[model samples]
Target: MKLSHKLYPFQNSDPTRKSLGDIIILHGLFGSSKNWVTVARFLSNFGSVYTVDQRNHGDSPHSEEHSIRLMSEDLEEFIFDHKIQNPVLLGHSMGGLVAMYFDLTHPGILKKLIIQDIAPRSYPFAYDKEIQSMSFALDGFTSRTEIDSEMAKYVTDSFIRQFLQMSLDRNEDGTYRWKLNVDGLNHARRVFDDVFTFEKTSETPTLFLLGGESEYIRDSDFGVMDHFFKNNHKIKIAGGGHYIHFTHQTEYLEILNQELSFHS
Candidate 1:
């Protein structure tokens, strides 16, 4: 259960000044620790910040299999390895799902949980199209510009396509490939499709932030959310999409600061 992690520390000065609670950020599937750099830096003002790359992504070791339970165990070992306590858990998309599972299974390690734009219920979303596009680009890209041109056909958003293309790497032989564990992710598709399920018992304070335009979190999910998170508050940011933290960093940071102050 030796899980790898990357630690980034910063200064914080609250009245208590007693380690204003560490913040652990988790990225989504196909994403790496790099995704949380901006937000993590901002949160560092409130406490020490740690952004983890799940097993199959970034510098972390890759595995053929992936599961919420296994990811939770990895996180447990990570927290213990780093001796982190009362961490403010912030996770995006798939990362949020894993965070929810971790907080439910190991309630004592985390003080507060922040779930962004994802519900615990199973979602019908499909990443097949994107995966196919990535694979196509990986098959062979004469140059980065070629990959970008191909991706444009499937991905309309120039920014998102550019962000995704960052995962593509060129080898010494000039072959293009992806840094992600694509095969493992494709085979474990069910795990990605399955919605997170857990009984409501833990009384940990949780915040659910959803993007107003994102379909991931909707009014229908509120009933179950109310049941699962006894001490919970749900907020939606207008004009925000699934990637709210990135799309609206300043706004999201302001809300996060308010949340920290409430607990401070």
Candidate 2:
């Protein structure tokens, strides 16, 4: 499947500056390329950045099947189709799983791998309320405020509600509808409970950016991470939550820049 993507070309004023190759960023569930526009623009100084929307999300073609394997395959196809050479791949949340699966299945295809706020282990189902709320919202709302109020019943976090709001689109008739494939995603929710098995370790240099306040990547998962990623380093952004890039943009960008510079 050809994924929908937006590219930010390197735009450094210095003519003497060399290109830093390609940087591909994958957003999390219910997220589109639009979520990474700020980060993409910032990374554009170093390399061309491509923010891609995985299947069943954004403007990408929706499929009944949605899993880490399929998404990784989509990423591989996108890379090959675009002729991206050893690009630096960054994945957040659900996207992180896709990146890990891709590297594990097709090692060395990526120059560097960055996994944000997710571990390889299976996670407990935590999106039931969110999915239910999204399903309700899909019926169409008169206003964004009304839909936000409905979502707030299930999701108390204002930040999460705002993030989910990005998936909404206003119809031509003025009704608000979810742009995401809600039914498809609902059917594929089982994928979240699936674990990534690692029979062999990947040699690709990887950076795991964890959030200090997030439970996604806990110390308990460090052993599994070490077994899977042989050439890996981890950094925790203090007080940052699952959405570290948004909650701690300065620290996140600083760490990303330093890591990419070192790898380059």
Please tell me which predicted candidate would have the highest lDDT against the true structure.
2
- What TM-score do all the candidates reach, one by one? 0.91, 0.96
TM-score of 2: 0.96
Clashing pairs in 1: 122-195
Q: 43-162 in candidate 1: lDDT tens per residue?
A: 878788889888877767778978777888899888887888788999888898889888777766679999999877776538776676676636656888888888777777787777
Model 2, position 214, has a per-residue lDDT of 92
Model 2 residue 86 lDDT? 92
RMSD of every prediction: 2.2, 1.4
lDDT of 2 by residue, 64-90 (tens): 999888999999999999999999999
Q: Which stretches of candidate 1 lie over 4 Å from their true place?
A: 1-4, 13-18, 137-142, 172-175, 193-195, 198-200
lDDT of 2 at 82: 96
Q: Lowest summed-lDDT stretch of 10 residues in model 2?
A: 132-141
